[model samples]
Target chain A: MNTILRYIFLNLFVRLIVNIILGVNVRNRDRLPEVGPAIIIANHNSHLDAMVLITILKQKAMKIVRPVAAMDYFLKNPLLSWFSQKIIRIIPLRRDVKFVKEDMFSDCYDSLKKNEILIFFPEGSRGEPEKISVFKSGISRISEKFPNVPIIPVFMHGLGKALPKGEAILVPFFCDVFVGNSFQWTGDRGSFMDMLGTRMAALEQEGSYL
Target chain B: MPFNIIVCLMGLFVMLSIASTVVFVLKKIKPQKDYKELSHRVKSWWIMIIIFSLAMILSKKVSILFFGFLSFLALKEYLSMIPTRRADHRVLFWAYLSILIQYYWVYSGWYGMFLIFIPLYVFLLLPLRMVLIGQTQGFLNAAGTLHWGLMTTVYSISHVSFFLVMPKIGGLVAGNGGWVLYLVFLTQFNDVAQYITGKTFGKHKIIPKVSPNKTYEGFFGGVIVTCVLAYLIAPILTPLSPIHSIIAGLIISTAGFIGDVVISALKRDLGLKDSGAMLPGHGGILDRIDSLTYTAPLFFHFVRYLYY
Candidate 1:
């Protein structure tokens, strides 16, 4: 009951704020998954991107979508820690791991086993708005672990202007999210990364203005 | 009844009637391309204005709360459009939280604390929040942006309410609520005057690259006309000398132009046509209030120095 109320409040809160202030223009919402466990891959540009994705996805899906964020970054303080874990329901992962231990892999595997959608940014960090960076192997690893689950690629544009790197002032701008058709993941390591990168790049190419 | 309050109420009614008539005529002649959308938007505006005008007349507390929420919405829109990295989320949270607290202080009538709330408390809190996140990448930029949004949208806007809460300027006056209304009226009038004059008589663009619609002729003409109106209206709403009323008009008109340009540049950089489509022909809440952002702070400081 509490979760339901929270979701309702969060949905209304985000919609009212975004529509009134941010002027967020959401498109291709039909592409989002109606039901099931899947991987949501998106471009990382602004902090608001996570909120935008969560807000839009919540409108369609029943089960809560969990965003995989860096523990070192989002979980560093009490307020943010609580907000991420409790409100946003983000799963925290250590970014600077020296080696991928069996324990770490199992934790991620366990999240997938729960039949929950997990959002991942293939680029470990935000990159230039004009270009997509070389993706890390996180998506491939998740794909290999959960071959049965669908991998959904999403592309977000205009958040870079909403809050760009090295600029503190937030200039008002419009942003759109495009969710692409999902595909089943194969355990093949090399092909998996290439396919993921290719799909993300295609989304970027289609969405890019310049 | 106090002479100024009675006169101001009469003037407000007359001006509102004129504005309504003009809007109604424009609706008939132009016949909005999207009539349904325009009607929806105008209905919302009527609701908002009715609520706002009632708050102003009925309860000081409600008026303060309404304006505070307006500033909060404006700031939220500004922040949502900017791109902050994951590292800056903590700072963003603090920045938004400060909006609530800043307005609360204004409502509570803590004059001294309200003065330092943003620069002292918020300035210190944002950086500390960033530091706690332990990532210095884009630290300076994120903190600075958060502060800028708060300063303009929250701190600046709260001053309008502050003017209302202030104790009588001298034993002769009870409160400067009239002055608050006067300032808003004059500033918005300057905006309308500039638009009408520029559209009618403007030929030479002031800054073609920045805002092509703005003209030197329109600017000077608008300022002169608004100043005259300010002079005529001041006695009805405020206890200002004619010279002071003229000064107030000049200040609001000139400062309001700067605010418009600043937000215009923001839109240009972002490659956007409108801030949002919340208002038809008016753009978003940010678009409508962009001029207020600058004028509010300046007018507040001016009233504070002279009266308080």
Candidate 2:
């Protein structure tokens, strides 16, 4: 009953506060995993992108999908910190460092291994909408670590317009979420990043108009 | 007390009877190809109406919060639909804060502060925010977009709450705040009546490019019917004379149509079908409240100027 209440409240709260205020639209969500351990790789444009993606995934998967957010930024403010951790269940990654400790990557690998979905922005950081930034090798590393896990590429267009990087007010606009087919990582580590980048680039091109 | 309870039960029965009859009639009509989708949409409406009724009856604060949350969603959707750059993020934060403050001002019944909350503070803060962010490129366009979101979402919808906060006019039926429910009921009724009338008698597309479903026949027919209904229901709902009620109905209905068209244009520009799929048939929070965005502000100002 508590779970039901939480779900209802979360739905109501998000509907009232986020979805209404931001006018986020989750499209082409049928391609998402209804239930399973998978990697949700989406284009990063704005802070709203993370919320929009996670909200839609929760709605689609009907389960909590932990988003891998940059710990430095999201955990800075107390209010945002609480919301990101409690409400969205964001898994914070220490990104400023040159090399992430082995323990952190192992924890992420464990989550994926345990059938939990992990959301990651392969670009490592947000960027301009006009171009998809060069993807960090972290995602490829994760994929290599868990070859059996499914990597779902999601392209989010217009999030930059919704709440751009430095801007606070959202311009009324429509955003699209295109969830592509899940694929496995079988290639060597050297070519894995190249292949992943190519796939992400393709999704970006396809969903650019959205 | 027994008599009052009996009368309330009788009224409940009558309302249910009327609703069922309408549903029966609608069911008898031939189902369109989109009937499944339409039925799903109607079911969602029933769920929402039930929720609204419960909230209104349960607590005033709950109802206000509910509506405030809705306005928040509508505003969010409006802003999301437009384009912005990285430089405009700070302004966006202020925009969200403005939504919260506007609603808070309304609930507090401080009409004086609510008046200039947006145009004064927000208008100034947005540019200053962008300047602080130090990105001058596309500054004007970004500020304008942020301002538009605040105007439509926060400033406009707060008018409804403002009505609730208005000093009650005398000479009306005692104990039920004057015309707060009246304007809200009539405006929403206008929306319902327009949709029904348009679907039934609509022909000769009106602004096919912007809103393909709207028609001139629907627009006029909805307004006339709503005005007549408003005239009849005024005595029960408000202190307005039949003539004034008729005028109010006409204003709300016509303005509501314009509201739909304006939001429709926004959606078209963004190449979107609905604002969001939060509501199954209703599209999104924005799609459902698009009409309210215009009607609430216009009706609030109209009532304030005329009555208050």
For DockQ, the strongest prediction is 2
Pairs clashing in candidate 1? Answer: A21-B77, A162-B81, A162-B82, A162-B83, A163-B82, A163-B83, A168-B145
The residue-by-residue lDDT of candidate 2 on B80-175, one tens digit each, is 556667556556766777777887888888877899989888888778878988998888888887788778877887787676666757645522
Best candidate according to lDDT? 1
Q: Which sections of candidate 1 miss by over 4 Å?
A: A1-210, B1-48, B169-175
User: Each predicted complex: what DockQ?
Assistant: 0.07, 0.32
So what's the TM-score on candidate 2?
Answer: 0.75
Give the poorly placed runs of model 2, Cα more than 4 Å off: A1-37, A44-120, A126-131, A136-148, A156-177, A185-210, B1-32, B174-178
- Best TM-score among the predictions, by candidate number: 2
lDDT string, candidate 2, A35-139, tens digits: 668888887887777667656754646465778988898899998897777667778888766657555576677777678888888887777754578788788
Q: Write the per-residue lDDT of candidate 1 for residues A1-210, one digit (tens) a residue.
A: 657655875678766655544666555677777665777888887677777777777554635588888889889999889877877788888777675554445555777787777788888776775346788887787787678888888888777656666566654445667677787776598888878777877877765532
How would you class the docking of model 1? incorrect
